[model samples]
Target: MRVETVLLKDYTTLGVGGPAKLWTVETPEDLKRATEAPYRILGNGSNLLVSDQGVKERVIRLGGVFQTYDLRGWVGAGALLPLLVKEAAEAGLSGLEGLLGIPAQVGGAVKMNAGTRFGEMADALEAVEVFHGGRFEVFRPEELGFGYRTSRLPEGGIVTRVRLRLKERPKEEIQRRLQEVDQARKGQPKKKSAGCAFKNPPGQSAGRLIDQLGLKGLRVGGAMVSLEHGNFIVNLGNARFEEVMALVRRIQEEVPLELEWEVWA
Candidate 1:
């Protein structure tokens, strides 16, 4: 197999990290073989934070073969989430429109039950095909034990594909909805960021709470909280992971003391 060292900054949306050991797998066999050694499966690297010293573990990245999309049936795990949603919408399939601007791969999205106002990926998932241990198995939505931002697959299990059942909708309606989501996302600040930094706690929004506490546009080094939306911490270029982490910690500390609401990381 091929192996290389890569700057995590180049792979992650935050654009801030050091080097990481990387391996790319194009087939299930390759994945199984790679898993014989210790490794972590990575998607588009949208929601993860690599340490300042970089990831100490080998990172397995699925390639184009695993990224395939079959709108009529199931989609491969490596498929880009936004691309899958776009393809499904263009094919007149409903249920993934609300995920329009979210950056992640199908495998990562499914693992986290990614969703928006319309609904989550779990809502459309019919079954999941996974490679675990040395064998493959299929799991229905109930069997997958889907919950908020988590799934049942064991820590090292690799998701191969997912069968989604989407409703048939008018293409025009689908396009309009996607456009609306896009418009809403565009209204947010444009900068280098890791999307949302923390999950909303209980019934309250992390953004609103952070904003209410007057943390908007707050800065630590080059990392700053987005003025457009408080929950997002944007990189103003030349920002480092340590700086971002420091800002995150500051938010966690200040918000609770100032507003009496605990924000999670």
Candidate 2:
């Protein structure tokens, strides 16, 4: 176990957060020990935006043994989703190709049901092993209440492992599908960002609405709406959390449309 004061921006993809009390746990025993303390679970920092004021709560990040997995589809929560997709494809497992580029760990991905138009984490998830109430417990997919970019997993619990059900498929076919998905994602901005800023309202695309309103390229401090994709708020350089929120608020207030934030602060 490692404990230190770390800048949130240094851990997140957005690069815009204050310092936080970070605790690194490398094993399930360590994680169980940590549940007795006040802490928030943090994954790979792919889909989060911490506040500039920072957080008083301690942060726990799974690592070491948590990043390891077996070919039987039993994976530790800290395993990278992209790596899983690649390994699964090579192993002729066909279920995670649509999520090839998502930069999330298994725990966060399961928490958010992260996915694309092709499929979601819930599609292949059989069960989740979580550290809760000072012990480990397994919950089935139906218990999670998986929905679009959301889940009903209870709070105050940390995911420890995930079981997936994948079918056998040709490696070449999986690679081709992965290539197609990658090509489709090219329009997303390459700037420092936390992917999409808002959830699509029902069937409507938040990006399309923002683009239609000509909000692209709009800037607030070092934060700006991506010209290539309106749904993305990119950090030009040295962006502050306030600047990103300013842009987000402006879009919500001016667009006269309901926008649900995808970035968590």
Candidate 3:
């Protein structure tokens, strides 16, 4: 295990946070020891918000052995989602292109069931391996209770690996779909953001609702509602966690929307 004090902002996509002690564990044994006390496991820090007053719990990041993966559809939890999608495409496997442009680790995607309109991580997942309570267990998709941006992963569990069920398809076809997804995401904000700030309620679009409410470009400190996508809050150079939360509160006051990202304070 490697221990270091890190600025949380440097690790997260939103670029807003204080500092915390980070532990990078290279193996399962290292991870087990790191989680023996009060700790929080982080993936790519893509969908998180840490406060200006960062928490005291040790932040755990996976490394070394946890980054190893194969084209046979088995992947380490620490592997980046986009890398896996690209690799699957090269292998002529079809099923994971939905995550092509997502900024997340494989494990994070599974935890959030990250996906586009076509499909979700759960659809390609055959089994998940996780460590909790000093032991590891495997779960099949049917047992995971996957839904919109959600999963029934065990509380406090750290995902170690995942096995995907992909189909043999032409590489060109997979590449074409990946290109389409890339094209579709061009409307997303290019600034630092944690993707959609609010979850869409059943039968309604959160972004559309925010747009209708005329909340675009609403600013609080250095944080602002994205002009390109109403569901996003972007960091204009130096955003603070409080500033982002203020914008969140402002949106909530006018729209009955809940947060889609996690907040750690």
* Residue 168 lDDT, candidate 1, scale 0-100: 95
TM-scores vs. true structure, each candidate: 0.92, 0.96, 0.97
Model 2 stretches astray by more than 4 angstroms? 256-265
- Give per-residue CA lDDT, model 1, range 80-136, as digits (tens): 988888788878999888788878888888887776655777888888988887888
- Number of the top TM-score candidate: 3
lDDT of 1: 0.79
Error of 3 at 18 (Å): 1.2
- Residue 78 CA error for candidate 2 (Å)? 0.5
**Candidate 3 global CA lDDT score:** 0.89
Report the C-alpha displacement of residue 48, candidate 1, in angstroms. 1.4
Q: Which runs in model 1 stand beyond 4 Å of their true positions? A: 256-265
At residue 216, give the lDDT of candidate 2: 98
- How far is each candidate from the true structure, as Cα RMSD in Å? 3.4, 1.5, 1.0
Clashing pairs in 1: none
What candidate 3 gets wrong by more than 4 Å, as runs, is none
- For model 2, what is the alpha-carbon lDDT of residue 76? 92
Report lDDT (CA) for all predictions: 0.79, 0.86, 0.89
